[model samples]
Target chain A: MRAPSKELTIDEVLGRIESGMTVGIGGWGSRRKPMALVRAILRSDLTDLHIVSYAGPDVGLLLAGGKASKVTYAFATLDSIPLEPLFSQARVERAAEFREWDEGMFQTGLRAAAQRVSFLPMRAGLGSAVLENDPDLHTVRSPYDDQEELVAVPALNLDVALVHMNRADELGNGQYLGPDPYFDDLFCMAAREAYVSTEQIIDTAGLTVDASLQSLLLNRTMVTGVVETPNGAHFTDCTPTYGRDEKFQKAYATAAKTPEDWAAFHERFLSGDEAAYQAAVTAFREEAQA
Target chain B: MSDVTRSEYCAVAIADCFADDGEIMGSPMGLLPTLGARLAKNTTNPALMLTDGEARILRGTPPLGQSGDVTEGWMPFRLVLESVVPYGKRHVMMGATQIDRHGNQNISAIGPWEQPTRQLLGVRGAPGNTVNNRTSYWVPKHSARVVVEQVDIVSGIGRARAEAAGPAATKFHDVHRLVTNLGVFDFGGPGHTMRFVSVHPGVTVDEVREASGCEIHADGDVPETRTPTDGELVLIRELLDPTKLREREVPSS
Candidate 1:
């Protein structure tokens, strides 16, 4: 596989971003999120972008930051992370479009896109207010002319996808050996360009033999770039290694209570280059160590 | 002693599962009882059951906490009486043997019933019920296979399609919601365009796309979902039916 381009700044990574591009992300319930990439996007002033993600903290930040225009999702991590602030505020106040789906139903929609079918048949409409409340989800005559009931889900053509993992090779073949293997590889394969962050770079061979689902779902070809951001998905467990620190999360939750607070927090946590991030974490680690 | 108080724990954590403006499926969390729980208000059935055992409540008082007695080997159903059954609205979130981005799911057999790549509970209320329940799903683990090209068997609906010659079409058509370990999502706003809405606390955009079996309408600067409130954590723990842990009944001193 070709080596990643030497320009390692988040700015460089994101300079290639364009409007109307579909983006995907990885993380679950404040675990293993790619903060560096997010911070970079926030500073760039990109707007009206469509986003895709599963459950986690990054979803709120994107909307609050005024970067995302439309969102597609499966689940947002954490138990009671109310979505009222993002959807209600972003749409009514900021004019962003926010919609929701049953967690699995969103996955089915992505599956239909992957298959390149006009519409996928499902038993979804039964007993669902989704059939009534949301005009987006509806029944259409089968384009295949096969008397099958089908749900027409528009194909998702993404511009980029970002993921965080336990380890990734030079070619972006990432591996996550965490207790909870939240969907990272699935999002990567579904996107056009994929970026990965990892705690360590290990031998590529171990990736194949590893029994974890994270490794099996991804291959070298799937990855676009890889960066060694140690303890990167940190504060969010990487099983058999370390985990998300409770103290930090509590601090973050409390600190990012408003937009201004979020911007300031992002500046401290995700603003600088890798070297700066390491210096800050190192300083914090040393303080705790002392 | 279990960290936060039970009610606070459930309330906060359940709220944490969604985007700030996203819709919910539970009873109390959906809307106030006086206001009729948010998700429950969507139910058309007059004889609908409330998450709290009440037929219909407006004030939305939480249900009483009462742990059940554990008998011999019945797998011990813990009395955390919280039920998504109230959010049993036209839309519901359920488990799956397999799931895709279109929101399709299967609790049916992966291989034969006995031996399989993954041994999941069979049928899981999807056979006849999927046609009636507005269903969504949760995949704690996201991968190519779990988020496969297509399910080995269609146990539940993902897209908007009518059953060919199977069960007759119901009032609702398909699953409208889908949440995973990564983010929250629904069908498209204008054209049912499937796109990524929000990411979880620590999740990155790339991880979601790779795990998803299909392409997503993802944006560059997606938002991060917020954390659940202390109250929500309690409700999710005590009320949303039992999951992950056993709700404790501490005897009054």
Candidate 2:
């Protein structure tokens, strides 16, 4: 028998997420994030979320919107802009519980979850304040003769994982034509359910036509659903399709400076569906040219 | 020549860190460090491997902000975390928002860990980088604000912290070098306090002492930082940074 289609709408995917659930967001700091889904969550009534990510604007948006109760991350940056303004503001105010891990330890935690293990041993967090700050992290001695004690990075299990890609089929095979695949696949494997939003939803065979086999980063088994959303990763980069919308990002960053500024920005751009957001962006670009 | 810029001097000092690193990955963070790593590869350390700061390992050192014609291998973020760091075959020169006499570096926050008055980049990879392999630092502007008595938070392991973590942490922990606008420093003093190796030309030991919050261990008269050779200057000016972008980072004094 042929496989059943696992296509979903933005709202349908958001329906699967619950309040206080651990949601893993895929992408590495203003890269190919699933911004469309993130916006949907922002629009939803979902609150008290526990977010895990190599964070970008998604963390900022959730924090600003007062959706997240806690955030676990290695870093939160907008690449060109060193520190994300919204995240920075959140940190200053003590808005939420922040669990900062070493980059390698964050990756190891995801790997542990992906492997369905309780924890993984690594030396990334040792001799650093990462342990002292987190406090719950423990060290384990090797069973072998060397008997080295290493930090046991606990598994970062997720209730749901949301990722954005270049292309995916209806059966949920995702492909990325970009330079780095990042840890998107691990996020999916570590989650109970995984959703992918793509620029294009093509036939399964077309996934490998132009792109190399290695670009097929996610198999159907890893993805619970797929959504076709063009320009989904706007502001953040979607790569070959589009670079980061620097002007829009600058505007967003500037707006984050004051509450009134953020309110105006929300009304102008964010207080809408994906289509309206795209239209507002189009008008924003037109205004810039004029 | 005698007409060497502070950036050029800094680049040479940064290059000196990788002089003995035979075949390890030379991962540099900012403008000066990038130029230094490229300069090292071109002149002294030909075997040094360089990444495009993204995924691909470069075939040869390319100019700043441009990937060259060819690549050696694929080294995505996953492989870097899983293989490269664990393998202990990399030397990284990262930036420091705050550093102490003990060499504990912080890029996390300013006031406090829980509720910071200002939040910098959250520990990105400093903890892993310090413990897993050789780690250096590049501080463009050095002051008492930056060279603090103690970092607000320890993102990178220093000597005291490494020793406390025991042999497992100390085995590969080498806080190699620190190059700043004012001077070059290393954790080589008695009890591994930050030691002044060389002060930049026109900069005095007193200036470094006044600028730093913590005590600097200078045994005797500190030497002047070396000026780049004509060959290195040519490589820096022509091949590496023709746009003189390095000047923006560490403007000529």
The TM-score of the first chain in every model comes to: 0.78, 0.99
- Model 2's number of clashes is 0
- After TM-score superposition, the amount by which residue A198's alpha carbon in candidate 2 deviates from its true location, in angstroms, is 0.7
| Interface RMSD measured for model 1 | 15.9
What tens-digit string does per-residue lDDT give for candidate 2 at A11-103? 999999999999999999999999999999999999999999999999999999999999999899999888899999999999999999999
- What are the per-residue Cα lDDT tens digits for candidate 1 across B123-154? 32353335654555554445667776556545
TM-score of each prediction: 0.52, 0.99
Give the whole-model CA lDDT for all candidates, comma-separated.
0.51, 0.93
RMSD of 2: 1.0
Model 2 lDDT, full chain set: 0.93
TM-score result, candidate 2: 0.99
Interface RMSD of 2: 0.7
Residue A242 Cα positional deviation in candidate 1, in Å, after optimal superposition: 2.7
Number of the top candidate by lDDT? 2
- Candidate 1 lDDT, tens digit per residue, A111-193? 55555554455544343333433476766565564555544444454578777777766666667665444556656666777
Question: Residue B182 lDDT in model 2?
Answer: 95
